[model samples]
Target: MKNVLNDPVVNVKGIGEKLEQGLNSLGIYTVEDLLFYFPARYDVYEIKPLSELIHDDKVTIEGKVSSEPSLTFYGKRKSRLSFNLQVEHVTVKAVMFNRAFAKKQLQVGDMVTLTGKWDQHRLQITVSNYQKGRAKSDAKIQPIYALKSDVSNIQIKKAVTTALSQYQDDLQEILPEEYLSAYKLPGRLEAVKHMHFPDNHQVLKHARRRFTYEEFLLFQLKMQLLRKRKRESTFGNSQDYQAKDVEKFVEALPFQLTAAQSRSLNEVMTDMRSPYRMNRLLQGDVGSGKTAVAAIALYATITAGKQGALMVPTEILAEQHFQSLQELFADKASVVLLTGSVKGKRRKQVLQEIADKQADIIIGTHALIQEEVVFQDLGLVIVDEQHRFGVEQRRVLRDKGLHPDVLFMTATPIPRTLAITAFGDMDVSVIDEMPSGRKQVETYWVKENMLDRVLQFIQKEVDNGHQAYVVCPLIEESDKLDIQNAVELYQQLQEIYAPKTAVGLMHGRLPADEKEEVMRKFAANDIQVLVSTTVVEVGVNVPNASVMVIYDAERFGLSQLHQLRGRVGRGDAQSYCILVADPKGEVGKERMKIMTETTNGFELSEEDLKLRGPGDFFGKKQSGMPEFRVADMVHDYRALETARTDAQQILASGALDENPVFQKLAQYVYNDKIVKGETLD
Candidate 1:
């Protein structure tokens, strides 16, 4: 069998070095990557001819040009070309924009085909893309790949075809033959070919299913193998904690623990007591008191004479955590903040304290993972917003002073099946309950026309000595969009309410010191209306802020809108969240509906998942998420259940444990870190 990874891009017959560089820019360095690059979408030009085409119908027509193409230039900047096509007795004009080259390609009595909507109201065929000849099949589906400006689908398809032709017969069947036969699926070679050039929709469906399942199954196997390897690794001594210390820490708390929090804490405590090491994830939503629970774990490690590290995402968040931890541990536990911005003698002293174990709890951003920041005896590591931190960073923190019991926390609620699929090997504890006194932020969706009234409401609130947050969707007006910008709005609002109210603008592009200064002013009620971006999504805790107005809310995802809503309603006063929407299209209307229907972050997250899949859930380029082509997280949830059950059965039966095929599968999963003759971790 030919190894696809070893086949070079240039080794494919027709590709040259210059073209290879362009392909490499798209991350297609080898034949395997090329084959794995699935099509983003398929355009099926499966419609009747223009003669049979109805008004307002999307049709594909095959005809010959009946007239010479003519171009009309409105000066040197703008121009349009027109041509008439004769399909039987009917003649329809085809228009081209700025394509004078296309005008030359069309001659009288030349064959041409166009696929687009026949808009009778405009009396035009709004062509998306034109072809030189009619499609071979009257009804045909053409594959379209995700391409950049430098590349196109035709070039990708040709390159892929060449690569496949060289290795189609020799590609390995990764799955066992018995299972492959049972499922009635084709071999890897056939599947890859069909994915690129399928004869029919049914064939394409099967090919996609096989490829997506393979991707997902390999991901699951990799995670399983990593878990096994990590669990089997050696660990240093684990410190035992005093029950009285934990009790004292809890008793001194300002509020009582929710039942969910208490349960999650107990789970952490048990994990800390384990001999090997602990790697647990504490999943919770906003205002679920996860930080307080983490404090308990930190306290336990301290009581055992070991230090813990709390790594957050941003400097703003790290500082907030540092202050809160200092207040909680006052004179009881030593805590210090470490970040990149910390300077001179203060940074040296903090580093010294952490190195000497004088500081029991060290809070910081990525600075905590630095080599110089050695631990005297690092026992536990608690990572907040675990997804925000890269895998290498987490591994570095894990490698610091033996295998510390790692606890990851995130406010974003991941669905249970996805959690199991993503973090299947790790133990998960979810705090589904919200803490008491967290008032539901009253949310309302308003049209663009109603924005003036919303501004009036904000003015009234600011007049009452309460602070307000006005978030713009963009930093500047985008040439392609009509969304409001923070800079423009800041100027307008300043003109409207300048002398009476102070207005400030904050965005991610701002300098760190400037952002901190603006936030400080807003927190202190100095800036009556803080005009900003989504930068204040999770960091601050302002008690008196009573209003949040989000402009162009339809442009944001449901979870994001909810996060902005969370900015308000932190205090005792009645808080309000106003979402400004254009209400022009279905997407805008749906976005507004999602904001008004519910206040629960979990529900919003589910809706967001339904709207947009896990394609970019973690970020733009994500790893380890099982991309099931058939199993939709929204509609095909039943398929996910089936897959989960199938995995369980395979694990439970001695077949996977004893069979040679299964053994080979497991070894492939952990090839880099394979241990000698082990059935289980």
Candidate 2:
């Protein structure tokens, strides 16, 4: 009701300057921030009677101190307190380590609670904590907060204890009273108190339910509002295209669309044909035909009397798509290529074609977003490898046209948790199934001892007129590394394959022109063996490259290894992905085993998310998911869905725009403070 919820952390007792700095490092600046900083996990000790207590079970029991507490000093800084407690006409021996301070507090008749494990064999309860009353200490449900190096548990608990009381009246309910009643949720203050220190498991569950809902609701509101704003932004039917043209274009393709591709295309075409502008993402494995689907969408845009723009991450990819599309469309649609290479007169000619409504589909790299590029009635925008480009870069290209329907295409299939959060603003379409008659890449995990055999195998493949890629993780010789480098591998492979096989070298450190040239040579089969790094992992289609040998494969994530594997299995020829590494750890061994077992990108991406954790999977700064206090992206998925549904209901009810409390909460969401750090985008 008041602005007092923004009380500074210094207002809390015991939070001095140094301590405040420590808390600040953990992103706690306000009293509210400290209040909402939920525990990483909870230590639950079920409070039970002596009868229900089992052997070696961590539990809490309420009883009387029937025997005087005996304190015995042990080794340095250690003491053991032994006592007997009377519970339901039964006396059980209790021993606690390093709790000599409680010796003075316990009398012969004092009622107390001890929480720990009951060792029935020895007839003793190994107590971890003792309290004056029932369910008071060692918390039947205790919270374990994540801490920084400088902060201590006592310091945070003390400050949080003070803030919990001082701001008790200030936590006005943001959710409407009716919904809270319907959900049987506790008051805001009660929930926060129970979250930090719960009396029992049932109360903690209810508290967690409340916070999880609130956290997800704020994020889903942001997502819903973004879509609503786009729909209301007035890009009308000009973005729409008839399905008949798209059908004819698809019918003309050399190969038929897979069922998954057809499903994805139908979803995209439905969005395109709507009065509202389309905003969708088509994500699939590397060779799942996302390009062909995009091509059909582009052709639809052209036939609808509007232009299409296909933006890629690299110049080489742009050139490849330009050539492929030019051949695919033939004389039906005028296609143009614009990149940094197209300079002076050539750039001017392409720009004029785009401006005069002559270029039906324009393909280029980041150069397409330059201020000089403009389009006449640009209706559809297809971005390849969309993650490689910045949000602003995509926006720049879209701005050149009056509200173009955008389709972002990525070869890397996103895990569902990431898809729901990172790309929440746009609708998603996934092509999960590969085309029929496609060759499944034969994958193998081999150790370093088998290097010679792998090399000989690559040479044998090259001798059969097929190209092979030898990928190293590093660029050059580093101080004391044991793994292969691109340059050394390039040289050694060249020396080994000699005279009979031509080898090319490519890595991230190579100049753009040099890498592109090497890639071109490999694609043309001029180079039978390409000793390169993961730079070749960026959707390079050299169908003739039938073998992919990943050096130090254990060093890469499952998703990256799968992407590397996808590069080789694109053609009709039988392909092989050899993971060359001697994995020393269980995780490394597991990664290699998984890579050898499955070629599904989605499955591998999920495994990657679990193995690497979400932070390393998507760099902390780049993860688009909002920072949540209590809701977990991985485990609290059902809560997230409920919140999303509730958010839509709230939006449809006009509560966000009309209700006073919701309006204030909406401002918090707009300022990115509701969930703290991550941007909703």
Q: Highest lDDT: which candidate? A: 2
What RMSD, rounded to one decimal, does every model reach? 5.5, 7.0
- Residues 494-544, model 2: lDDT tens digits: 788788889898888888888878887888899888888887878468888
Error of 1 at 234 (Å): 5.3
As a whole number from 0 to 100, the lDDT of residue 31 in candidate 2 is 88
Give the total clashing residue pairs for model 2: 0
Give each model a TM-score.
0.79, 0.81
lDDT string for model 1 (398-423, tens) is 66635678888977777665676667
Model 2 local distance difference test score: 0.82
Q: What Cα-based lDDT does every candidate model obtain?
A: 0.78, 0.82
**Pairs of residues clashing in candidate 2:** none
lDDT of 2 at 554: 83
Which portions of model 2 miss their true places by more than 4 Å?
Answer: 13-22, 40-151, 176-187, 199-206, 240-242, 386-389, 398-401, 477-482, 658-681
